[model samples]
Target: MLVTTPHQDHSATDLPRTGPATEPAAELALLRGDFEVHLTVGAEAADALAAWAEEHGVKFVHILLARGSAASQPMLTLRASGSYTEVLAETRRTARRLAADGFTVLRAKVESVPWAEGVPASDADAARFGAARYFEHHVKLLVPEGAATDGLAELAVRHAAHLSRNARRVRPDGVREQFVTQRCRLVGSETAAARLDALLADLTAAGHQVASAEREFVALDSDETLDAGWIDEVAAVAKVAAVSTAA
Candidate 1:
């Protein structure tokens, strides 16, 4: 369940004169919303963390390799998701377990804002929202630094054609074409998960090194409900894709 700190009573004169009232409005309600908990773990612990999430059926937004950190150890950002309460609980549990195992875990809370109230009141709000939804499951097929780009153009053409059969650009009328020219493509959650095998096979066969992929969900609308199943599918695919890249 979502919990909020109780607001203290204040006189009207004590409220700000230049802005909205300080008092919590009755119309302002808290809803059980989705959120992600971020934690940094060393490279030695990355595989373990990923395995734990898979074993426990936890969903993850992304896992990023932290660069230029002061620590000698390679660091990674392990992001886990759930409702506010669940994320807090899971983060604490995972932190405790990993710490006991001698892994350094630094945790941070990434809270979700109320969609409607958070957006700026402007004419571009609709465009902003549309872009958000379309790129909700955006994944990047990264090429390793210093890797050969010799065949990249031809490979991208072939890959784009393959993706066209399964993906559609967020804005079909937009100037940029997916797969063909743009490396980033918008795909359905299920489609992305289902295409992992083919994607891996194609990229590897083309002498392309897929170093890593990032995944995240951007809400289409303020009130959009997250699909736990879709999140799980993404999490699973991400894990497999990461392993494939390492191999």
Candidate 2:
């Protein structure tokens, strides 16, 4: 016989970040691209969910009774890390398996955090560095309005040799599956923010009608963990650039 309990209403003030006591070590070690799997189950099936996780080698990072619009429901959030492809595949398989086991699977969502080598001094620093690295290393260029694309392309070509000289290839874990190709994709734009600044400056100097610049972020790769905080310091300047562009 299957046993189930009615959904209860949890007071808004009673909800904790991770429910019960917090686990500092596990929370701190979480990296970008780590999977956040949310599973909703019947109120009385918490034990069954725990058993299923144990049998499947999945670790439950947090379990909480979340208040829904109408009622409170038991929710499980788990953390899993691996290559993008691997994590996605495993999440799908787990959801399918759970549904087949006579449990009501409400929803499963995956959220990715940017990877950092070590914990930031604070959350503010993390956001600063995260934005910087995103713009500098991940982004290729920011071409402002009416900027000479031909001139920029020519500049990139001319600086290709010099940029290649300073380029550094990152191959973490001795695996070629993920690597960063850091090359001189542009001249004058040595840093992430500098690239945008230079592009806008050049256009203004040349008397071009500059309204704003176009932006492009780097493509996603399997090696996000490599050099996770490489551009934190440089990104400080980028933070300013982002604001300036928006203004």
Candidate 3:
């Protein structure tokens, strides 16, 4: 996906591939389209009447029926899709209908449906979940008020480049499917946060923020998030490549 470079000053031209290596023509095809809409809608019956009331987004909705008429099962799950702007407009319209019908609704939950999982609006969408859930995060890094503020520009440059490597796009929660990852090459959020903290140790209380809420479409079998262990994969590949070269 083509992302707007967050800042003009950062140039990360040699960023590594997140997706597989592709022919130039294949890459062009990937870029020549708008991202179709993908997000999940969650709402529940406030009472028996609302529970059975014809659900909004029903065509796209995943009905999580309350165990019995008055019972609570898990929660509502509706997956909506279409052109980006139109899907959102339609979802908001559906949400309004649900609220009016008396269902308790959480804000729409955004999900990243990767290729292995299948495309949005598939007949099998109801049966699929992604390899892992993704987060659309906003990070705040400021110069320490009392510390040397001279490095803020440099740090900002690095941060912007880092974000580009990890995410599909740099956009807001509702406009959908945005992702955030650290550029420091450190994987854990806590460790990454500490690195930012130590670097900014003074002045504007420089640190990071996890300002987004994440949701998954289905029960994830693993807790994997960051690429903390990527080195092993790279090392294993390099070892075989080296052997092949020598042979």
Candidate 4:
């Protein structure tokens, strides 16, 4: 993946400067590409949906189902592949089964399909395929604000501490087959560079190689060959990375 440098300051007319720009930038990134599935359920419905998805080979990146306002009511939000036609077919199958079993289909909506950053529809196919490999699963963890005045410095200290203690025990929550792990790395924005440097220093102290560094991201390597342990460590690193990057 091509690492992006810290953005140049925006002109006064271009964007508001009352707060941090990164928040809005992240929001826009989310808007650029996403797919959503909406469904409502009664008791035992979520289990049925999971079973149906498994039986039909319907893979998704994230599947979130929550209890609604009343007892025995549930709602699901699923994000999956970008292919609309194929996804619709899968949804239909699920709906048919649910309907036959006397469940209610509240609303089915296909939100935005994933699209290339700057590619026009005419060239979307080639652009999508070329850019698809760059997609990585990012998990963000919030840094708590304590009684310290220097939030950034405190963030660094806590991050380094977390890495030392817990950067190797986080296990994946059964999403492994749907999402693949690639070259796991640490990353930060310019605002968080000092904290990043501190964390990277801790990583090096632990004997992991600093594989690469650019303004947007940093890469780290394990002494042992990459395996499930590395995957767990990456999850731990992700927690630290997220807190550091969070404003």
Per-residue lDDT value at 218 in model 2: 20
Q: Candidate 3 residues 40-155, lDDT tens each? A: 22334323323443333222323221122321222233454433233333434544444455544333432323321322223233223232222122333322234432343334
**Of 3 and 4, which scores higher on lDDT?**
4
Residue-by-residue lDDT tens digits, candidate 4, 1-247: 0111244333322211232221222222323333454444544565665565455455312222111132232334455443343333344445444555666654343333324232122333223323111122212222222322243223333442211111212335421111112222222122234444555565456443344432211110111121222224345456766876995
C-alpha TM-scores of all predictions:
0.30, 0.30, 0.25, 0.27
Top candidate on lDDT is: 2
Model 3 worst lDDT window (10 residues): 217-226
Query: How good is model 3 by TM-score?
Result: 0.25
Q: Which of 2 and 3 is ahead in lDDT?
A: 2
Q: Write candidate 2's Cα lDDT for 60-130 as tens digits.
A: 32222111231223445556654333443454455555666766654444334433223233444345323
lDDT of each: 0.36, 0.36, 0.30, 0.33
Give the lDDT of residue 65 in candidate 1: 16
Our tally of clashes for model 4 stands at 0
Q: Write candidate 1's Cα lDDT for 1-247 as tens digits.
A: 2111234223333211232332322322221345434444544565676665565455432332111232222222234334433444444555555555566653333333323223222324324333323222222444443443446444433432211111222334333222211111244334433444445566678665454433333331221121111122344346556877999
Candidate 3 C-alpha RMSD relative to the actual structure: 20.1
Error of 4 at 15 (Å): 40
Q: Could you tell me how far off, in angstroms, the CA of residue 54 lies in candidate 2 after the best superposition?
A: 3.2
Model 2's lDDT to the true fold?
Answer: 0.36
Evaluated against the true structure, the overall lDDT of model 1 is 0.36
lDDT of 4 at 154: 32
